[model samples]
Target: MVADVNVFVGQQRFLRLIDEETWATVPAVDPVWVDVPVTDYTVRNRPKRRNGQARTGSYQRRYGANPSGHPSGNLVTPLYGFVNEDLEISLAQLMMEWGFADHEVKFPRSKTAEWQYVGHDNDQRHLGLRVNTATLAGSEAGIVLTLELIGQSSVSFTGAASPPADRNKLVEFLFEDSTFTLGGTPLRVSQFQWSVQRNLDVIYHNSHNPISMPKTQFSETFSITPMKSNKTYDDLRDAFGMPELAGQLVLKGLHNGTGDTGNFTVLTIDFDRLSLIDSDESGGTGAIMNPLTFDVLKPDTADNGSAMTWTEAA
Candidate 1:
């Protein structure tokens, strides 16, 4: 007999962020943000194997027979997209899982204050995630997350369960319209790429499963057309040797504004300690462009708090 197979599309997928306040509990809040650029979501649980040696000195490996080991699991998802005002808010929540603090501050003259996201130590903060696809047949299918650190076992798994009502909730940010700033100058961006990573240190115990701690870092690279009299190139050259002379990149989004009293979404990234990791100033037949890369550094402190900021529009 033949079987029917179904395939999934890239764009029809959505990622919802849930703040699981505690371990193994269902989240209660509505998804922080839906329809994030989640390229792939994977769950893996692989355990080490052991072989048995008999009296005859012959080795035999039996599958699931010896059961003499602990296992570890991992859930991995890669997200990518164009940077904008609204998306920055969701991105901030995602970064928080990798260990960042969400700081809310109210502007003196405004009703709503801007938000500040700072890098945080890799504490034992557990989070929840949901990945689903809107199918062509108008149905939804995906995995629900409920995971806890396996005691003495370094395993991770997405527990199959409905999210609860008391889950930690992140603020909602929507996309309306946005503007971009490169090197403090206003321009529409053509390319933007950024990534966040956690460096995990595994700790092993004498008679228990190993545990892992994480340290997080991020990097970004982008390309843009050269503007007439643009000093970005020269500025980058000057900053190349002097790390303190790094620049800034800002993005702002506006909503429901007739004059100025509408809502605003803002993001600011400082490159003060960033190194010019890569650069390309092509002299080809096309419009001259500059593509640059930076190694993100913590500015002026061990916490590296000056890397980025997410400010809510007043």
Candidate 2:
């Protein structure tokens, strides 16, 4: 028999985050386009053996036996994505589930939102998923969102038979457009990546299915390449030497419409506040580049406000 040609595309795949633990609620918006190759999934099973005694023809002998295995397993799935937008609603929800705080911001001509890290000394972070939403349009508005959901029961799939087109396709239809700014000064960027991870604990009680839930501590890592400078390099060098001196790092991404004059949509991804605890200053074989790593943290100015921000404007 021939394999079905209904391959899962970027558009067919959707990601959502919710506050409730039942895995029941689904967001109204469509999921942001995610790179499936990077998203990983796994299932582990535990098996037991049996031993028995048997009688031989001449003398009694001990023998080994095999028995049917029981259902003892855990499930794990990790998702990764690169969003070019100013804000990701699902990420805000995930931040909250992981003990972070989310804040809404209003700008003179923009709509903005922020997520702040607010866990005490140490707490395990959490994440969940669901999918539905309008396809993303325009040139530079997206935010990377990663989530991990675990359940003891079997897998479940729900969606319409004829879903929407490939979201990646729509993204490609538009032109290449994005702007990166750091501390109000436009910075040249060679590459950038956003990563988030969450894990759940699985416990087996006196039942066939296992119980799994998210852990307490979850965080993000922002990696990018910035030009080497005397002051900047000295700051990073000093921070690495003195962990306590590493201050907050800020970065932003602004997305405008496709060159068309009629289009008026604009989006911004702002990482106004983060912990700059790590840095790498390597004189590359070809071009010497200074790569920076930012560990997201709570805003130093306020306890309830946000450290990272996103904005969408007409």
On the 0 to 100 scale, the lDDT of residue 32 in model 2 is 33
Model 2, range 76-188, lDDT digits (tens) per residue? 12211223243443222223223222232110011111111122111112222211111111222333333233433332333222222333322211113445565566766
Cα displacement (Å) at residue 202, model 2: 3.2
Model 1 global lDDT (CA atoms, 0 to 1):
0.34
Candidate 2 accuracy as lDDT: 0.35
Please list the C-alpha lDDT of all candidates, in the order they appear. Answer: 0.34, 0.35
Model 2 residue runs over 4 Å out of place are 1-21, 24-149, 156-160, 165-169, 172-176, 229-231, 239-267, 300-314
Q: What is the Cα-based TM-score of model 2?
A: 0.48
Cα distance off (Å), candidate 1, residue 58: 6.6
Q: For each candidate, what TM-score against the reference?
A: 0.48, 0.48
Worst 10 residues of 1 by lDDT: 107-116
